[model samples]
Every structure is written in structure tokens, then in C-alpha cells.
Target: MELLSAVPFVGGALGAIVPFLVVLGIVVFVHEYGHYIVGRWCGIDAEVFSVGFGPKLVGWTDRRGTHWQIAALPLGGYVRFVGDMDPASAGKADDGDLTPEQRKHAFHNARLWRRAATVAAGPMFNFILSFVIFAALALAVGRASNAPVIGELRPELAGQVDLRPGDRILAVAGQPVETFGEIIAAFVRANGAEVEVEVERDGEKLAVPVSYRLASRIDYVNPGMPASRAGLVAGDVIVAIDGQPVASFYDLQLVTAAKPAGQEIVIDVTRDGELMTFRFMPDMVERPHPVTGETQPLPTIGIRAIGLGGIDPTLEPRGLGEALESGFAQTTRIVTGTINYVGDLIFANADPGQLGGPIRIAQISGEKAEEGLMSFVYLIAIISTSIGLLNLFPIPVLDGGHLMFYAAEALRGRPVGNAAIRVGTMIGLSLVLLLMVFATYNDLARL
Candidate 1:
């Protein structure tokens, strides 16, 4: 009976493994199958369609003679074309002298355009997967909770500007504002210009004049800090610090940092169309150096300053076209943000702790999946989008690399030489190995 009871626990554990593996396998299979299908369509012979990598664990051969196999590693899969020297090769030529019939089926014998099509299909499938998933999610879930609208305005600023909570901004400085993001971006870019602000409030459109004020100081509180304990959040613009007028977040930070620890400070904030005040004492936090056994004192206020702005809620939900466009726009923003964040870390401008690897992704996937089906679907969409974007990067072993080679071939009227291919392959292989090592190290460090 005890052994029977344990079966449920064992089954549950096995069930957990199945979903992760299944999802990963499906994604990789779709990517590789893209190449296989396109290659066959172009009349090029594909020798193998294998899932995962490393040593083969299971195998089967189809009537067409394509060897299908499941490998030990579950990371990714690939399709091997006949006459291809290596995965990265453009299949410039078949080194072994073969019969005329065999030569016709060789990858190198295929027209340049066909070969390019085969290589490009992998990333193309990834993008198609992303778009379809996004469209389906949007159609099923409807739009995300409508973009935040102007909830409240600071009394000091309110007196100067006639805008109120629930006012929908139509445009700023003559630029059309379709979403809340556009409105805030326009406001910041205007930077105190005598800009014309058009808004819709209570079904009435109103035009108002507003100027941007140069930000002086910005205060960012660490998460779980005393400020958060006092109900302070990231977007709360501190209009007053310690009952003193503050121009920017910096001014608030400077004053709070200069104040003695445990001194109670009053902070005034405009949030979601309401004015609120909070009293809190800054806690002294210690930062210890890893190399040196030394510590530094820093103010602890748990919260990060993203930006200060009121969102206009009067904007209506977008149509299908607009929603799809917004999805693409969001994807672009995510890619740019990721690159910029990575650049920041490389230059020591940002914390390295933010970097994560496969383990982190898996943990996030599990957590998000546990939240609900919608959350899990959203995670899949994001991963698909990221995979698409990453494959588009101009790395030699990636799909983009093949496209690069094709472009060169088109320009030069011939394929790149074997020597060039060999060098590029070596460089690409080295880069991939190095990145995997770095990612694994980062993952382990977090653990």
C-alpha cells in the first residue's frame, strides 16, 4: 500500500518533466522541420532529421531513407542535408567524387536561391510561430487591461495645467498619441516645450498648453526598503521631500541621503489620479564587497523609479490591425531593451545579477505556467519572439549567417570559397561554445 501511494508522487514528478520537454521539443522540431521541408521541396536530399544533439538514443528510418533519431541532449535539433560538409556550410561542393545521379541530389547541386530558401526557412518558421501565437492570444484574451490613463496630477502642476484624471490624451506637440506609451514618450521628448496637449475627458475634447520641466534629481529605492514599507512605489514622483519642494527624483534622493538615518521624512506623491502622502524613515543598508572585506552604507527604500507620468485612460481599444502592429512594436522594444541592458552590463553601467540562463528561464516558465493557462501562453509567445529575434542575429552558425553568405554570393556571382567557410565556421563554433559556458556560469552563480 505504501509503494502504491508513492506511485502518485512519482507520476507527478514525471508529469512535470513531460511538459517542459514537450514544449521545448515542439519548438525545436518546428524550427528544424522548416529546413527539412523546404529542402525536400527544392529537390535537395535531407539525410537526417534529428531531435536534440550529442549521441543518438533512439532511431528510425523512413521509407524515403531519412534517418530519424532522438539524441541524448534535449537542447535543440537539426536537419542534415546531403553533401553538406558541416552544419554551418553552404554546401559549396561535394568533396567526394560521386555518380551523376548522386550529384543531382546533392545540396551543392541545388540552385543558390533554393539553398538560401532552405536556410532562411528556420528563422522564418520561428517568426510565423510567434505571429500566430500572438494573434491567437490577442483574439482569445482580448486586449490587456487598457493602458493606464492619467489617474491624478500634482496639485502644483495641476494649477498650471488643466488636465485631470480620466483625461485621455489625443496628442502631444502635434504628434498623434494612440497609446499611453506614445503620450508619455512625447511628453518626455518635448522636454518643457510650450506644447499643445489635446485630451478627451468625459467625452469632451480639450486642448491645453503644458511645458516640460527638466528633471533635476531622481530617487530610486531598493525593493523591500523602508520607503516601500511606507507604501512608496516606483512611479511615485516625489513632488515634495521632507516637506521641501523637489524638482526631480535626484533632488529627493540627495536630500534623503543627506538626512540622518531614522529621520522621518514626509513624501508627497501623485498616483493614479490621487494625491497621497507617506511618512517613512530611511533604513541604513550595508553593501559588502566580495574582494575586500569592507562594507558601505546606502539608503534603503525598496522601489525602483521607472518614470513619472499620468496615463490617459480615454484611449479606446485598438482594432485587430492595430493590435498586431502593437505586438510587433512591443517585440522591437523588447529586443532593443535587451540589447541596451546587455550593453549596460558590459560597460559596468548595470548590475550583472540581472543576467540569467536556461535554468532561470525554466524556473520562470514553471512559475508562470502555474499562474494560469493565459500566463503560460504569454510566456510561450515571449520565448518564440525571443527565439525569432536571436536567430536573426548575424552569427555565423545561425540562420542569419547563411543569409549573409547568400548576400555575398549574390554580390560576387559565386559562393564564398571553402577557406572562408572553414574560418567562419571555426569562429562561429568558438563563439557558440564560449557563450554557452558564460551562460552556464551565470546560472550556477545565481544558484
Candidate 2:
């Protein structure tokens, strides 16, 4: 307590919480503003525009009879349009008894398309905010040059490969290449196999094989298994296999599977900061495919990679064209990757314990902010995209679910029955509460 007082502003837990508050404030402000503005444009009168909930700290009634206020809590905001049942937009069963003037301005009485537009605006604004942020970020930092010139060649591996600085990469595995992204794509597409790359140096073009996979760590070795018998220990990093670069566990699987079982393969690994090469013959084993659920014979050295460790994303500025291209590409990649991860969890292929609540978000927010502005902005863009995507899920109470209801209205030429809405709302609220409870548990467990 004394230390926190001495630090004054942004001290201790307050400091950590600041980043989360700022991020949430920005997202909430944008989302609520979308609702407010679009509702106004659609001729729906908003009764209140409040930042936060609970007791009001400061407030003013506008000339239009709208109460604009900053409430006690700083967590989230809401736009309470006229005729709402409380501020949740839930309709009352007796709303039809309102005066004609009130009914004319009621959101429930608005045209179907207008209501849909107002409801969808929140997530749409989130996506727009993310796209703009990403585009601006591109202009702030210059991007790495696409020319095949080598910069810093990592030690140990550099000496083994016949490549040098100032060498321009011409092609990889017979495919033409021009950028580092392309080079990485080639490596991933080849799995973990070595590829011959053509290079040009001082007017002389030469061909050199290079393996550029990120290091993989062996987390487990089956007892008395091939890997264990060969004296490979857990925590050993397998940077290369059979002189070929090893990128990921999947890469390790692909390369080893391509080889006939019982064939001796040289494995290069690093343990305790020391490099060691070991000889081992992989055993043929049947592993179930993720998609087909069928077991296929694949060679394995009886080792599995834990996961990637300590990856730092690098950002560079680029030409207007390139930057714009990268901006869209990165956003799309994040969206697709998030969908895949969520899908995996739904299918029980992923661990539910990985889910996190607001507590974890605050921790991550502080950590990313410490990494610097670019990284923090990147984090914001990612979270914004995620929030937008999450709200679009067809869970009953979400924006997507509301849109689903609107679709039904369009099909049936009538609003969803009040009884159905009441039941769905109950179910929706339950699911949301369950999600929060589950995620909070995960966060506490992690802590």
C-alpha cells in the first residue's frame, strides 16, 4: 500500500488495469455510438446515452429529452432508446397501450430493416474501427524489403549453408520468390523438407539449399520409446531434422512420416545451450487424422512438440499499396484463425481451460502495452476484430442472433412472438452468464 501511494499515478494494480479500461472504453464507446447514431438516423428516439451503468456520477438532459450521463461503473456503456423495457431493449408485453406519438417513436414499432440496421451497426462499427487502425498502423512503420537480400543469418546454421549476405534470393525449390513472406510460405508448404534455393551474388548466380524453419521443442518422449532410447530428453529443441530445418511439430511429423520406418535419420537438437546430433530410427505407428478420424501409418521418433515459446511479432512499414494489401491480409488472417480456434474448442479438439475472462485480458493488456505502442495498437486491432466476430455468433442474445430474428421477420412478414422472445432472452442470458462463469474459472485457474 505504501509502495502504491509512493508511485502516485498508474501504480500497482491500477497501472495494469488502465490499459484494459482504455481498450474497453474505446471499443464500448464505438459500439454504443454506433447504436445511438444509427438509431437516431432511423427515427428512433433514444432516452438515454450512458457510459457505464448503475448510479449516475454526472449527467445532463439534452434538448431532445435524452439523458446523457457518465455512470459509476466504467466497464461498459449502453444506448437506451425510447420505449425500452429498462435499458436492455427488451420490450414490455403491454407496449401496445402507449400513446400514438410514443408508439410512432418506439424502436419496436420501427420498420424491420431499420431495426436490423440499428442492431447490426454495433459490430459493423467495430470492424470498421479495426480496419482503419490497421491501415494507419501500416503507414507508421516501414516494412521489411521484399528483395531476397540476407540480413542477419543465425549462427550455427549459417556456416552449414552455402549462403552469404548480399546474396539475392532468386527461387526456392524451383519456384520463383521475391519476398520473405514467400520464403516462409515455401518452407511451410514443403513441411520440414530441405529445399534448394537459387541465389545471385555479384553477377554470379548460384544454387544453394536452405532450411529456414523456426525451432521446435520436444516436450515428451514415450518411456523406452525410440526418442527416449536414443537419449533425447524433454525440453530439447529440434532445430533441424536430417540436416533440414524443422518448423513445427506438424513439420516434424511430415518429414519423419515421409521417410520409411526403421531408416536411420540424424536429428540435430539443442539442450542446455549446447547443440547435439543424435541418430535414431523412427518407428511406424498409426495416428488418427484430425479430419477423417482414420488411423494412417506414420513414422514417429516417439516425440511430441509442446508448442511455440516466446514468439515476438515484428511490424514494418510499407509502400501504400503493399501496406494496404498487408492490412487487409492480416485482418482476414486473424478472423479466420480465431474462427478455427473457436471451432476447435466447440468440437472438443481444443482445451476449454484456455478460455479467459476480463482478469486475463487486463494482464495481457498490461503486458502488450509494455511491449510498446505498435504492439499495443496491434493488440487493440486483434481484440477489436475478435469482439466483432464474437458478437456475430448466432447465440440467441448476441447481435447475430438479433439479426437472425430480423431474417425470420423478413421471411414471415411479422415480428417474433413475444413468448418466443421472452424464452429466447432467458436462454440467451443464461448462456452468456455460463460463458462468463466458465471463462472466469479459467482465468482464476491460470492465475
Candidate 3:
């Protein structure tokens, strides 16, 4: 009902809400269930198995004495075990008051291996859910994307480069490129250099020479500006402005911003590997900023840049296993590439604005969802995989952290001291918070 009210004009609001809620609920339920089932198998009694996190909304106790409930917060859920000093703690307080039989069933009293397995199940379940969902989607719809072979080349750059349309990009400089997106990203970050691009053509690898050009001053259109009227898209690599070489999108923007209204400029762009020239006179537009409510002048661009094709749709569709394998492989490559980019940013090899958070996720999710259900599902799969991997990071308060502790305990024949866990938890929490803040700042800056 609330979902219907949220989108009154859309007749399928209920339908959409149902699927969204079902998917989210299922993921949370499975994760908690993993903990509960493993704990029970380890002879520990689960006091409660709850879906969601805040105040309890509705629940019931089973004959086995496990309270099953749905909480108010839908973000995450948890399972509480008997004699758990803290819901998530690995150590227990003195249980002298408890009967010997009850004490035997305490979570902390369980074997170290059992306790480790219980903690590890939550994240394992998350990954299992992701893999299953990804595999199913791939099997049902088949992954969609263009091949990495060059389909078109910009005329301006083509004149200076020897690359051809059929060439399959293998690597940029010395780094291997697994996808077209990765290739473009690497190209942009390289700036101006005599880059060596390795390509495969006619079964032979060839190195192509390319140069990166750094733009002078770049100007971003404010909330309301004449540039917006002429049409502009983010990521549009502007090559020329007013018959002058612009080098980068920023250069074109700076030149236009300095010119007054009613001055027409010729803009040359390499959109989707095609060279096109456009003439536009910017008109100033005004809009209230969402955060400050202050009126601002932003450039208006009516058209957006279209990306070049890379995915090959002609490949024969495969079965579930094959599809799943390919999906996993592709996801792994993407994750690795992203990690490399993060390192690049840290070392000042990449721009920090490429980082984004919830705002960007929502923007992308909304846009992909609008494209179709399949596209939306693909986005979800990518997000799910990313989340699964992130949770596996060896940071305290994460599944991987518990596993690390388990390993230490296994080797030392004793649990790590509480002081160590506390310190690690603090460190992990601080790192996560810092990352969130940085991502949020980047999101706002882009706006």
C-alpha cells in the first residue's frame, strides 16, 4: 500500500515494490538463517532469528523456542544466540548462575571451530545469494554487452594513430584491459603520453602509438547556464572549441564560459567513435540548488554523448553453468580493475572525482531501471557481487575479520584477547566511516 502511494501514477508500483522487497528480504533472511542454522547445529540455542534491525514489528516463537520476527528497519537483520555476552561477541561472561546443562549450550562454550563456522556463515550466505542471483539472471536473459573490438575511431585522432576498427584492444601501456570500459577509463587517466596500446589483429599482437592530451582550464556548467541549452553530457571528451584544439572537455567548457551569451562556437566531439561538429550559442538558465536553495546560472546542453558499441550480441547463448562461470569471471575482472583504480587514485595516478557513493548509485540504479527490468537486474547483480566482496575484506567487524581471528585462534590454541578485537573493531569502523565521508563529498562535488 505504501509503495502504491509512493508512485500513485504508476499502476505497477505494487508489482515493483513486491519484487524489490522480496529480493531484499530474501537476502537478509538467508544471511541470518545461515548464522542460526550453523549455531543450532553446533549445539548452541538461538534465542531469536529476526529479519531487519530496528524495533520489532511482528514476530512469533516456534516450538524449538526460537523467536522469529520482522523488525522495523529493512536494511539488515541478525540472529541472537543464547549466552552470547554481546550479540556478536565471541567471548562470554561468567555463567556461574546458570545450570550446568544450560551452560553447556552457551555459544562461547561451543568448540572454537563451531564458533568460527557460525560467525563465518553470515557472509558466506551473502555470497551464495549473489552467485545464485547472478547465475540465474545470466542463464535466463544472457549477459548483454559489445565485444572489445574497435567498431569506430574518431577521425581527428585516427589521422594521428594507426589503430583500425577490427583491432581488439588487449592492453593499454603495459596493463591488460579486460573490457572496453576499462580501456576507455585507462585512456582518460593516462593524460598525454606516448602510450603503447597492444591490440590483437589477424592472430598477431601489434603495438599502436597513442597520445593523451591534457586540457587547459575546465569549467562545469552551473545549475542554469547557456551550455545546457546547446546540449552537453558528462564524460563527453571535447576535442575542439571555436576552431581551436580544446584537448579535453574541460578546455571547451572554459572557453565557452568566458564568452558572453549570443556568441556561437563550433564544438568538435568524439562521440561513440564518430566525429561530429556542432554549432551552438549558450543560453543562461536559472535553477535553485537542492541543498542551498540558492539560484545559480548553469550551462544548458540539450544533447548527451552516446557511447560506442563494445558488446557482441551475436555470441551463442550458453547454459546456466557456462553463463554463471562467465559472469563470475567478468565480475572478478571488474573488481580487480576497480581495486587497481583505487590504488591509482591513492598514488595520484587517477582523479578522485571518479569515486561516488549512495547518490551516484541511486542515479545509476534509476537510470538503468528505466532502461528495462533486465538492465536493472544486471545492475543489482553487480552491486550484490560488490557488496559480497566488500564484506569479505579482512577488516574487523566483517566476516573476513572473524575468519582471521579464527585462524589465529586455531594456530595459538586460544582466542585473541578482547583488547585486540576492540582495537581492530575501532580501526575498521573508522576506515569505513572515512570512506563513506569521502565518497559522499565526491558525490556532492559532482553535483
Candidate 4:
């Protein structure tokens, strides 16, 4: 319902909220379900399995007597096991008064390995989800590969431009490029300005003038988005933003990103050789940073750019087996990239603004949805991996922190002093709260 709302009031963010909530709900349900199911297998009785926190909304008691419910706020979820003093699953003190049967099924009474396994299951599930999703995407969508070479061109446009199959694109708008990605990037940097493309054909390079073509043009437009609402059409060539000439699609990004959200700006475009000028406010949007996994705000006109002069394929699409292989490799790259970025942030080599919280996640989820179902599913895997990695941080109030305590217990050959755990819990909660506040602040600033 929230996502169904009209465009965001100030930043046009209202629609994003729904997709964000959907993503959060799925992840939370998967996480808490892990804890609940694992505890049950370990002979620990769970009192409730809850999605979200705060006031309860709808629920039903299962056959095993565990209350399953959806709460009003869908931010996070939890599983409350028997002998737990609170919803956080902290152990109940001095369980000697409990009946033998109740004590037998109590979480605190479980073996050390069992307790550890139960706690670790949540993050473990997240990792598995990531792998599964990645594999599925690879199977469904062909693995990305190869350089930009025109293997084919649309029949109509093939006559308009001097392009042909087997021509390897070497540069766009005079920007040297090798791979398809670089070619796309070059086009983006051109925005809407007419340019030239150099290609290698028959061992000889030729420069083709695309003076009548655009560097970047709209390919997709979501209804109610800034561009669509402002009367911008797909295929429109953006010539300028705020009177400054745009040379590349990336120019649009630079021009808008530097401007504050909700700020009004003039845009000049030529559609079918008819030049037009329009004034509209750029919407402030929060999205995940590509490298850092942090949330940052950027201005958007709500348009996706398409390849301008056309494209040629140099490599064949990979088969399912190859796709699966590449998919796993891709996920690994994401993991390593995120870890490296986080390290850079900690060492003061990177900006702290690279850290984003729920808002950032939500924004990306919505944008991905607009891209297509495949993209949205891919985002799910990425988010799942992020959750798994975050939970593994050895801080209190998280699975990793609990594992740390269990490690101490294993070394000491006995359970830790309740006093120490209580202290650690407090410290962990404080650190977690601090992170939330900081991320929230960043989100607000971006909006």
C-alpha cells in the first residue's frame, strides 16, 4: 500500500518504500525462520516467531505451540525461545524452579554446539540464499561476456548509419574503449551530444561520424517519474541540463548529482529534430553505493539510457553450466569487493558516507524492480549476502558476538558468567544503536 502511493512528496521516494518493505520482510522472515527452526531441531521450545517489531498485527499459534505473527513495523524480526528473558533471546536466569520437562526443552540447557549452531543458522541461511539466487539468475539470464562488436543491427537503423557486423568498437565519441562495458560507459559520458565512433574493420580502423545521432537517449521511463511527468519521451536526446551542454550520458549524472534534491532545473532536448526546453525539479533519490554498499543520495530525472548508435555482439551467450560457474564467481567478486571497500572506510581512506542503512537498501530494491524482475531478484541475492556478512561481525547482539561468547566458553570449559554476558549484551546493543543512528543520519541527508 505504501509503495502504491503517488510520487514522493519532496524527493519522490514514497513508491520506493513499498518495495523496500517487501525486501525487508522477505529477508527478515528467512533470518528469523532459521533461528526458530534450528532451535526446534535442537530441542529448544520457541515461544513465538515474529516478523517485525513493536505492536502485533496478525498471528496464529502453530501445532508446536509457537506463535507466528506479523507486526506493525516491518523493519526486523525475531524468535523468542523458552527460558529466554526477552525477545532478543537472552537466557532466563536461575532456571532451577522450572519443571524438568520445560528445562529439558529450554534453549539455555542445550549443548554448547547446539546453541552455537542455532545462533549461526540465521546468517548461514542468508549465505545459502545468496548462492541459490545467484545461481538461478545465471541460469535464467545468460552470463554477461564479450566486447562490443556489431553482429547485427536493427533493419531500419542499419540503413541510417554506416555500421556492419564484425566491426569491433574501439571507441565512442572519441573515447577509447575495448569492452562492451567501456563502450556503454563512453556513451553515458556523452549524455546527448552527437559524437564519432571508431571501429576496427578488416584490420583497418575507421571513424564514423554520428553527428545526427545522440550519445545517450531514453530507453525506459517509469510512469510518474520525474522525466515522464515533465513530458520527456523515450528516445529524446538530452542536449543540455540547466543550459550547460551535455556531452555524455554520464554528464546527466554529474549535472544532477551535484545539484541538491528537489531543486528545479532547465533541460534542453531535441526530439525528432524539434528542440524543446522544459523545467522540472530533480528528485532526490537514495541508492546503494556500487563499491561501498553505503547509501548515497543523487538527483534523478527517472530515465534509463539505451545504447545510442546501436550494438554488436562479439561473443555468444554462455550456456547454463557456464552461467552457473560465472554466477558463483560474480558473487565471490561482490563479496571481496564489499569487504575491501569496508576496510578502506575503516582505515580512513574512504568516506564514511559510504555506509548506508535500511533506506539505502529500500531505494535500490525499488529501482531494481523498475529495471525488471531479473534485476530485482539479483538484488535479493546481493542483500542476502550483505545481511550474512553483517551478522558475522563479531559484535554483541549479533550472531557473531554470540559465537564469540561460545568460543570463550569452549576455551574456559564452562558457561560464561551471566554477569559478563549481560555486560557484553549492553555493549553490543550500544554499538548497534550507534550504527543505526549514523546510517539513518546519512539517509536523511541524502533525501
TM-score per model over all chains: 0.56, 0.63, 0.56, 0.68
The candidate 3 region of ten consecutive residues with least summed lDDT is 1-10
Ranking by TM-score: 4, 2, 1, 3
Q: Write the per-residue lDDT of candidate 1 for residues 216-235, one digit (tens) a residue.
A: 32233332234533445444
RMSD of each candidate relative to the true structure: 14.4, 11.2, 14.9, 9.7
Residue lDDT tens for model 4, 7-126: 111244766777777777777777777887888888989888888777999999988888999988676788888777777654464688667877889888899999899889888777
lDDT (tens digit, per residue) of candidate 2 on 266-364: 889888899888765555557643223357977666676421111111334577887677678767766775575577567765445545566666665
Residue 74 alpha-carbon offset, candidate 3, angstroms: 3.6
Please give the lDDT score for candidate 4: 0.68
lDDT (10s digit) by residue, model 3, range 44-114: 88877877666999999999888999977665566777775554453455788566876888776789889
Give me the overall lDDT of model 2. Answer: 0.67
TM-score of 3: 0.56
In candidate 3 the C-alpha lDDT for residue 188 amounts to 50
Off by over 4 Å in 3: 1-27, 97-102, 143-315, 341-352
| Candidate 3 overall lDDT versus native | 0.59
Q: Relative to the unseen true structure, what is the C-alpha lDDT of residue 353 in candidate 4, on a scale of 0 to 100?
A: 57
lDDT of each: 0.61, 0.67, 0.59, 0.68
